[model samples]
Target chain A: GESVGLHLPTLSVQEGDNSIINCAYSNSASDYFIWYKQESGKGPQFIIDIRSNMDKRQGQRVTVLLNKTVKHLSLQIAATQPGDSAVYFCAENAGSQGNLIFGKGTKLSVKP
Target chain B: GAGVSQSPSNKVTEKGKDVELRCDPISGHTALYWYRQSLGQGLEFLIYFQGNSAPDKSGLPSDRFSAERTGGSVSTLTIQRTQQEDSAVYLCASSQVGGIQPQHFGDGTRLSIL
Candidate 1:
């Protein structure tokens, strides 16, 4: 079965530092990717997204880098803050499918 | 003015009991979705609706799970003869379009089958 997985289950970072979360997807046909942040007791919120045509996309204080060669994707957060502590998940949109397949999220904890 | 809303934020029922979860998507949004998340598990796609047309229920885990959207607004997911394995957070999300659009989610209903 095709699946999306993460490199780490949890990541800890000091406030004001940088954080990077990695994900690996097995389905090569997946063309769209998105990153979502989920706080405790809340629904997952959209953070950023990137299409297969683009290798990298940047948002406020966040960046998503895609490497089609190795089927790897990464989300980088600059100047991480305490509020950035949450679970991050990477989802893939394969072909014309309306559903997004999610990865086992990475829990990010920021220490002040 | 609302993003997405789900009913009965938490539910507890015994095995073999039937449960119904409701979802009210944003006004004017045509696409709605239902997903499940278990403890320490990722989001599991369950069903999707596009307007009042036929829904794509391929993601549903089993024949015991079913969902319906009414008037292209409110949706309901029903689980029959729920088992202990059915314990999970039932999340509802809505997007402006079906594909390539960011999905807005609700807090979800946490269902526990004892």
Candidate 2:
């Protein structure tokens, strides 16, 4: 198992502002990256994903940026909303083994 | 259901009791995974099942923990002689047919060992 870490444990933002949650991974061989948002007492919901070949991938209101060089990944949420508040986690897959190494996660709090 | 489903949303048992947790994956999905999340901690890989072949039980914490998938549709995770440290949320997830695909998770079964 590889170590996936987060730079921050918590982030608070106001409405309409952009939010950036950073993650650092140790497995350089990881080829796939994904971001998941989990609400209280619920399972993780897929937000966005990016392959190692590409540096960035975007989805509605969210974007995932990967830096293979530094083994770092970040999820950016545009126009933060109250509904966007949750714990975000970054997961990485080294290959086709189907095992995703997960980070400890960062709690995102969006203010109304 | 459109997403993965798990049974026994909450379980409380005495120490040394054996319990089973069941999971019903989405139809036609051949890949299933089980993970454990401790309090204030991240998800920990437990076991993975692909199709009908031998499951990858490397992530299992000890011999007391085991899992099985029947017909590649439903899965059951059993704990033998439950311990106090075994208290945690057990989550089950399913993916298309390969590891590269995204995984859909269930609400998870909250197991409390008293």
Candidate 3:
């Protein structure tokens, strides 16, 4: 079945550094994409999202880049903090129904 | 500032037993969703319900898994004849009218099948 996946299963970064997580999606017809952060014992929290019309979207200290041709999506966190560490998932909405198909997620660990 | 709320944060059941999980979506939210997550993994889509519309149950793992939403506000996912693989965190989310809207998620229910 078609699904989204992450390039890195685990990422370790130092505090105050920048971290980048990458995702590859298979469905070409997807129109919306979103990033979510899940902390331990908690539900997934919305981080950032981008539409097919634009190639990039920026949130507070977070940026999402989309490359439609390659079906690649990335999340960049600036000045990474310990609290920023979590499992990050990228999801794609293929149609107007808004049903999201999620990626396996990448565990991000920040070393202080 | 009320978000989605789920009941019985954690549940422990024996194999072959039945369990029901509940979700209370954000007030006036017209869309509701259910997902299952294994430990250290991504979420698996379960079902979706739009106000007064038929639910999408394409993701239910087997015949034992079922869910229903009443009055477009509360939803319950029922699992019959549970097994060890049924243990996971069940998450529910809600959105505005359209699928283009961002989904707001609840804390989730942790189920452990013994």
Candidate 4:
């Protein structure tokens, strides 16, 4: 079965430092990927997304790198802040209807 | 106010009872999705709806779980004969279009089977 998974369960970083979370997916046909941030008691919020055609995509303070050859994906956050402390999830669109398969999240803790 | 909406922020019900969760996608969104999140775990895809097409219920956990989308807008996920293991957060999300679009999510309904 096709699945998406994270490399780490938790990542702790100091404020003003950079953070990188990694994910591995098993589906070769998946063409779309997304990164979401979920705070305590909140839904997963969309952070950034990248299509298979692009190797990298950048948002305001975040970047998503997709390596289809190795089926690896990563989310990079610059100058991590307390507000950025949350569970980060990586998802791949595995179906034609746009259903997503999400990886077990990586809890990001930014220490001030 | 423009994001997806779900009703009953939390629900506590005894085992064997049936409960319904609601989701209202963003206006004009063509795609809607439901997912479940167990405590400290990741999201699991439950179902998907796009436009007027038939829903994809491939991810539904069991026969006790079912869903319906009315008029391509509001959706209801019904769980019958709920079990203790059904306790989780049910999340709803919508995308402006179907393929490759970023989905916006709503605060989920926390269903606790006591």
Docking class for model 4 is high
Off by over 4 Å in 2: none
TM-score against native, each model: 0.97, 0.98, 0.97, 0.97
DockQ for each numbered candidate: 0.76, 0.78, 0.80, 0.85
**Backbone clash total, candidate 2:** 0
Weakest 10 consecutive residues, lDDT, candidate 3 chain A? A92-101
Clash pairs for candidate 2? none
- For candidate 4, give the lDDT of residue B39: 97
lDDT of 4 by residue, A1-112 (tens): 9999999999999999999999999999999999999999899999999999999999999999999999999999999999999999999997777889999999999999
Docking class of 3: medium
The digit string of per-residue lDDT tens for model 3 on A1-112 reads: 6789999999999999999999999999898999999999888999999998999999999999999999999999999999998999999985677889999999999999
lDDT of 2 by residue, B42-100 (tens): 89999888986545778899999988887879999999999999999999988888678
Better of 2 and 4 by DockQ: 4
The sequence of per-residue lDDT tens digits that candidate 4 reaches over residues B1-114 is: 688999999999999999999999999998999999999999999988886554688899999998888888998999999999999999999998887899899999999999
Model 3 CA deviation exceeding 4 Å by range: none
Looking at the true structure's interface, with contacts defined as alpha carbon pairs within 8 Å between chains A and B, what fraction does model 2 recover?
A: 0.65
Q: Write the per-residue lDDT of candidate 2 for residues A24-76, one digit (tens) a residue.
A: 99988888888999999998888888888899898998988999888899999
iRMSD per prediction, in order: 1.1, 1.0, 0.9, 0.8
- The pairs that clash in candidate 3 are none
Candidate topping DockQ = 4
